[model samples]
Target chain A: MNRMRIGDLTERAGVTQRTVRYYESIGLLPSGEREGNGHHYYTEETVARLQKIDQLKKVGLSLEEIRDVIELYFTDTSEVLPKRKVLGILYRHLADTDQKLEALGQFRSDLQSNIERFERWLEANERD
Target chain B: MNRMRIGDLTERAGVTQRTVRYYESIGLLPSGEREGNGHHYYTEETVARLQKIDQLKKVGLSLEEIRDVIELYFTDTSEVLPKRKVLGILYRHLADTDQKLEALGQFRSDLQSNIERFERWLEANERD
Candidate 1:
């Protein structure tokens, strides 16, 4: 198993070292091994975990929610029941994302209408 | 010329008093009148300004950019040329909003694809 220092892990994961430490502090990430020189070392699995964290954040999961998802990923993989349970969680997340997209669409329309109002003001001012 | 205290202004504008004070501290809003006991009093204009700030925030304008817009609203209305200049600024903001909507649309698609992947995994696991 290839191991990496904290710096290397942060660089490979495209997250700041401070963010990685914060995640660990919040229990969103696992603690790493301490070397003889007091440096931390992590396995390649840390990289994969960080990537998953980034993906979950992009999908709008809070750290607490991501922790829940991570727990689901690790617990009881010997049966199909866990996968079915995960499907239900994912479906709820899907609905949340859809709601977010709907809100964004509404904001976009508001911006358009405001722009039109400003344009009309400009046009009327130009005539005066 | 009806005057209101900070609390009244915030209540009418649907923002917290702290937010109104922060806007004043940041120079995005003018400082209010100070009473004999040192309480701040504001006019109805503060209410309109807070509403404008809220609308600009919804459209994703930074405080600095919103300050610029506010300046444009206040400055040099004697000529149509200033209105034209403001139109240019608003056009740039329109482009930025469009870009944000595009990125949000992309994220929505990614969420949909992830949901499909989870559904497939659930189906495969159920068969086993």
Candidate 2:
């Protein structure tokens, strides 16, 4: 696997340098390997990790929440410790997803009713 | 109708003073009526509006998005102009809610399978 510097990693991952640095600072990403030339380099794995983080963010997971489950995507699932830890995280995320699903469902219903109400009004008011 | 100050409004609405001011600034909440002693007073309706905005926020609508539909809750929906505008917003929100529901459903399935995988691993490894 080829190694890339932070600039290349961010470009490939479509994230800002600050995001990469922040993830590293917060222990969400591993510290980049220091090269002999005093430059930090990352593996292709880091690019994938950054992209995965963005995907999780879109699904409404916080950085802290992602920390609980990010390993599942990248770590060897055959490992025992992370699997147990991730099992707990997975259960928690399932509950959160259910709650979000309920709220979104309710909001969808409200939107539908409002849309129907508006359409009825327009039909009554606009003679066609 | 009894008019209350901003303090009462936020307290009843379960939001901060800054939230009230911000919503007012953004036209999500109507500006509080100016009182005789230079104090800003709001009606019961303002409290309901603030509470409604919080509900929309919980359902993941941005402030700008809320601005589009908040009036539907407060204004007379019989009016033609706002009805047309909100019809567009309601349709957009319905589409967004469907997308969210689909994504959340997918994530829920992924989590359930992961949980089951971990459970199977633990069961096999423990021999209990």
Candidate 3:
């Protein structure tokens, strides 16, 4: 298996080096290992995790929220009881997403109305 | 009409005093007047403007973006050509809003799937 450094992981993930470092600094990402020359290195899993983080960010999840979601995947699932914390995070995110959708929908509707009003005004003036 | 202080404007707009000052500093809002006592005061129109700014922000427009939108209202509309800058801002925001809606929809779908998977695992364990 090829060992990936920060540059390789960032290139493959299409994220900036600064963003990768910032994620690690914020504890959203793990700092993998140090090479012989003292340079940091990452595994393929880190690349995948970076991609996941980017996807979550596009969906408007905060870093803290993404951290909680990531915790769900690493949790041991073979146990009898499911992770209650994961469930709580998911429920909260769902409610938040719903509110965002509602706000965006209304914003879109208002935009359409304003555009129509502009068109009407233009037409009324054009007839003169 | 009576003049308004920053406190009165913030209270009417449901925004923080810090936010009002920040907006003024960023030029999204105008700093109104100095009284005999050297304290700042805002007009009724400023109160209305603050409310408009707050409404635009709720719909996800950045301060810079909101500034462009506000310019549309102030522009003289009697002229034949419409304000191109305002139109550009609105069109760009519309496209951005559509993209956000798409991403949010996808995120909601993924979240629902994860919740269902977790529930299924929980039920399977209960049956054992």
Candidate 4:
């Protein structure tokens, strides 16, 4: 079984060492075994876990929500039920993202109009 | 000239007093005149500024970016040029929001697939 240091894990995970430590501190990542020199050694499974965290973070999952999902992943409950719950959360998040997108679209439109109005004002002033 | 109290502004703006103060502290809002009791009284123009802030916040503008936009609004520069710059920033924000939406869509699809796979696994295990 291959083990990796904290720096190695962070490099492989494509996240900063501080982020990895923060995840561990916040219990997003499980604590690794410590060596005699106080260095933490993580198993290969840590890479997969970090990848999942990265994916969830990319999807805008809050750290708290990601922690809940990670807990569900580790729990002994019926896998189907937990996954269904996670899917429900994902659907809700999708709805939120859609709403945000709509809001951004509106903002973009408003900004465009403001720009055009300003252009007219400048043109009118320039003729004066 | 009509003036509004801090409480009134917060209520009308649909943001907390703390958020209003924080915005002011971050210079997103201009400092208002103080009454005899040291209470800040805002003019009607404040409402429009607050509304703009609310709209920008809805579109997920960071406080720093929002401050820049607000500053541009007040600057004596050519209105057309400033507005054009703001529009550019809005366009970039729209692109970012679109990307985030795409990522969320992918996450939702992945979660749905995970749920279905888990269901199949449960069914298979139950039959054994």
Candidate 5:
């Protein structure tokens, strides 16, 4: 469907209602259009915006930075964006993503060790 | 030093004073012990606890969920932990971390594609 309610939008975007409301309040997302029945309805574009926001967040862009660049994603053309500026944002995001990946990899290793240690300790100390 | 003031603790832990205070208020961290100086003091263990909380948060564990399993990391020995329960929590965290890794990988891929598209468009549209 081209139009949906907040519940459907959130379900489709994989974000919470609070997130949608917060984004709308902060101007990162447009407020849903009110229909003739007095119910607010969001379009598929809203779902895409929410998903884009989520993706940006995963790369550690602050909401302010996301606000600055989000329109480029949905806007009519890339010619409007300054050449170097857009590339700068992309490069920074790539760097941020790499750092996160490294950190998460380290964390996963640590978690695994802790798990193994617990298993060994349980085997030694816990009686069946 | 075994004991440090809150300022030092926050700096060492790379967390904000607000985070330290909130953790203390929520019983997620021990309130710093007070001495004759009237200023509260935290220990190295407190720093480690803050770090553990951060790691757990990065893997998407809620504060409540973190509380349920945090002590296992700091407690004296593994015997006190119920064998199956601790294993279950560790397994769940591992699964959560894996899911996060996958999502981040997807985000990274999408970002790369967007960057390439912008680059190509800029090359075609902008000239010196």
Candidate 6:
């Protein structure tokens, strides 16, 4: 299979070329091989790695944490148990996200009530 | 009516004294009167002001924007109409927050699917 260019990899991953370069610079992604034309070429695995990074980011892992996890996934001697431990981390992240969502929901409800109160005050003042 | 100390204000507001001081430093809150003993004293209006700040913050307005809004509320020549306009800005913020929440929800579902896929891979590997 032909190696994909950086642009192609970014398009396939649904992320901007800038984001791809940033990921590479931060070591969250491997640097692509440079061709004689100064263009970077990525292997098929690049897309999967990008997807994993995106998944971890969505679950609120910092780039550093995601990098550590990726390194662990690749270099760890023990695979199954380590993977299970990573799953536990993901579970905790999910729970933390749920709690944040709940807090935001409460904030939203409070704001709605405040808005209603303001409206009522406006109406009451108009009557007076 | 007797004036309250900073601690009392924070306790009543369900926020920390440090947060209150931080708010004051940022000019989102007004500095209280300094007594001879160096303690700050707050009038009942301080509680109302803190509540207003909390309400704006709940709607995700930045401290700077909240300060501008508060200044406009207090000093603007035109009152009712400007208050209505501020409410419009708040409505837009609410919509933006709702969109973010929906996007986060979609990300959560996608992560859940990825986790299941990873689990299936583990099961398949164990079988082999």
Expressed between 0 and 1, the share of native interface contacts present in candidate 3 is 0.46
Q: What is candidate 2's lDDT per residue for B1-128, written digit by digit as tens? A: 46998888778889899988887787777787785778888988887788778777777788998888877778776854666667777887888788777777877887887788889888888954
Q: What lDDT does the true structure give each of the candidates?
A: 0.73, 0.82, 0.76, 0.72, 0.82, 0.71
TM-score of each: 0.57, 0.80, 0.79, 0.67, 0.75, 0.60
Residue pairs clashing in model 1 are none
Candidate 2 chain A lowest-lDDT run of ten: A79-88
What is the lDDT for A84 in model 5? 78
- Model 5 chain A: ten consecutive residues of lowest lDDT: A75-84
Please state the error at residue A13 of candidate 3 in Å. 1.8
lDDT of candidate 6 over A86-121, digit per residue (tens): 667666656756765665576567557656766776
Please name the candidate that would achieve the greatest DockQ relative to the true structure.
2
Error of 3 at A29 (Å): 1.5
Local error of candidate 5 at A29, Å?
Answer: 3.2
Q: Candidate 3, after superposition: displacement of residue B7 in Å?
A: 2.4
Classify candidate 3 by CAPRI docking class: medium
For candidate 4, what is the DockQ?
Answer: 0.39
User: What TM-score does chain A of each model score against the native chain A?
Assistant: 0.67, 0.85, 0.76, 0.60, 0.71, 0.58
- With candidate 6 superimposed using the best TM-score fit, by how many Å does residue A107's alpha carbon deviate from the native? 2.0
Candidate 5 residue-wise lDDT, A7-26, digit = tens: 99989999899988898899
Better of 4 and 6 by lDDT: 4
Model 5 Cα lDDT, one tens digit per residue, B32-128: 8888878898889899999989977765567988887788778864547677887898788788778778877987787798889888887786677
Candidate 4 lDDT for residue B48: 79
Ranking by TM-score: 2, 3, 5, 4, 6, 1
For residues B96-128, write the lDDT of model 3, one tens digit per residue: 889888988988987897788787776776755
Error of 6 at A118 (Å): 3.6
**Candidate 1: Cα lDDT at B2:** 64
Q: List the residue pairs that clash in candidate 3.
A: none
| Tens-place lDDT digits, model 6, residues B2-100 | 599987888777788988899899988788999788889987778878887776665456788777556533443245456577667657656766765
Count the clashes in each prediction: 0, 0, 0, 0, 0, 0
